[model samples]
Target: MNRIEFMTELAALLQDVPVEERREAMQYYNDYFDDAGDENEEQVISELGSPAKVAATIKADLGSQAGDYAEYSENGYTDSRFDQKEMPAGRAYQRKEEKEPPKTSRALKIVLIIAIILVGAPVLIPLGVGITLAVLGCVIALFCAFIALVVASVAVAIVGIVVFGVGIATLIPELAVGLALVGTGLILTVLGVIATVASVKLCLVVFPGICRGIVWICRRPFQGKAVA
Candidate 1:
């Protein structure tokens, strides 16, 4: 949607927010869209995703920032402290505590870890093992195919050489058959070599991508923040 529609939707969603805070958020986004210019309006909307998402993110951020305010009434003296806007929604926020290692009771942590392991062991372990085995199976199959192609290529070339040699060593009667065998072996050798080369190239291209995909999948669970 255009900037006007986007802003209107955002304002509607933020109606429950404090008037001043809502105005501040609207103004912030308005200025952002203004700076982006008409040419970049679509790009901005796409980048920000839906207005509803931005509003929700803002409320979530506000709630987390106002966690301490939970104990106090809305009219408390500390209300102004929570009135301050958090960092904008589209970017990552890192608290100082999040940067440092968290402290936890050793026994509790152990118990929690064990509990998670036990709960997920039946599913996660098998899924992980299955994925690994599948990948390994693919690699092994490719490797074996490559080996077979290379060996076949070498065997065909050897046959061609031997047949050609025999043709040259012998006289007229066996010469034609020997020459035909040599030709057939040479064609087989060429086809085998092509197959081997193609297989090697495919393995080289495909396995690295598979490895990177697996690494990305593995890292997602550990990452605390995700792009909206």
Candidate 2:
């Protein structure tokens, strides 16, 4: 359907909603359409789906907020911190209350935290230390393994060169023995080259990726603290 027809239907469906909320929702969609330009009018309408669907979502959100407000009022706390704003289609309206916790509640939380710390300090401290040590040990082990692989690869290449020289010296004495040594040296050298390439790739790509993953995991808990 076209924008005007769609909006008309949406308005009719939202008649039961509060006046201010309805107006805000309407204005938000109107502005959205203006911003999108006439070229994308059909695309926007398609993305919004049916007007009845949009109205139902808004009504459901309002119902949930009403329930929350009712519960808040029943608790003998009154807040005049209501806020309404226009949003995108799926979230056409938002109502938020920016109320701080009561002083008593905040004090209670602090007391509870202190109590927990006092009771659990012995176990928590050791547990945290053990976890940290385990992670460090794993990282060290991986690094040592990488170093060992690189060293082994280089050692094999060096040994192959020495064996190849010995084979050349032995060639004059025994052709069969010299040929066998030469073949063995070539195989070892090829294997060493392959291992070295693999180690280089691990160092340049895989190891850094693993480190980044660990860092991301460590930061996850602190990332959204402001929102909390």
Candidate 3:
């Protein structure tokens, strides 16, 4: 119904109620009617049902002591005699409106706590493997380097020993010094390979976890709200 029609029906219904409650209910509804436009008012009134139905419900709810003398239709509605009849207003009508929250809203929360152990373990555990592989590579490389140094040292030592043997047979000290230099170079080269392999493995293992975290963060907004 239009605003005017709705007001007319409300006025009719409130006639039997006490004055204060009647006015309050009427005023509240009037304010509501003004706040909403034609489309909304129509929708609200439609939901509330016809004028007679609305009036009847309000009268009953207000606790009007309707008796057998009260006019009702075959289906217990006010019949023709109730039309335009004025009853008292200005009584208390306890109107309590309860508005329920939307059923589909989701609460803000922490969903998953990614276990750091699960992620870091895979990256760290393989460091041992990488270290072993690098060490093996370095050992092989250093062993070859060491062998070259040793052979070169030995050849020089023998030549020195022969040269000294020609000069008085006293070049043993020079041979010993050359062999010691060859051994030291082998140890340092092995360490470098071990460090290199570990670095490669750490970089590779952590990459996939970072990528997964990025994708999950991006999709958070689009996730559907929980229906409760």
Best by lDDT: 2
Superposed by TM-score, candidate 2 places the C-alpha of residue 1 at a distance from the truth, in angstroms, of 29
Please, what are the lDDT tens digits per residue for candidate 1 over residues 1-228? Answer: 788899999999999988866776776677566656667778778777788887876676468675643222232212332233442223322323436667788999899999999999999988989998987798689778757766776666566566656655553667677677667656765765676677667768876887788788778877745642
Candidate 1 deviation (Cα RMSD)? 19.9
Q: Estimate each model's TM-score.
A: 0.39, 0.52, 0.26
The runs of at least 3 residues in candidate 2 whose Cα sits more than 4 Å from the true structure, single-residue gaps closed, are 1-104
> Total backbone clashes of model 1?
0
Error of 1 at 122 (Å): 4.8
Query: Mind sharing the TM-score for model 3?
Result: 0.26
**Better by lDDT, candidate 2 or 1:** 2
| Residue pairs in candidate 2 whose N, alpha carbon or C atoms collide under 3 angstroms | none
Relative to the true structure, how large is the alpha-carbon lDDT of every model?
0.67, 0.73, 0.53
Error of model 1, residue 149, in angstroms: 2.8
Clashes of each: 0, 0, 9
User: Per-residue lDDT tens digits of candidate 3, residues 69-98?
Assistant: 243333232322223324212112333446
Worst 10 residues of 2 by lDDT: 75-84
CA RMSD of each candidate after superposition = 19.9, 18.7, 16.3
TM-score of 1: 0.39
Any idea what lDDT model 3 has?
0.53
Ranking by lDDT: 2, 1, 3
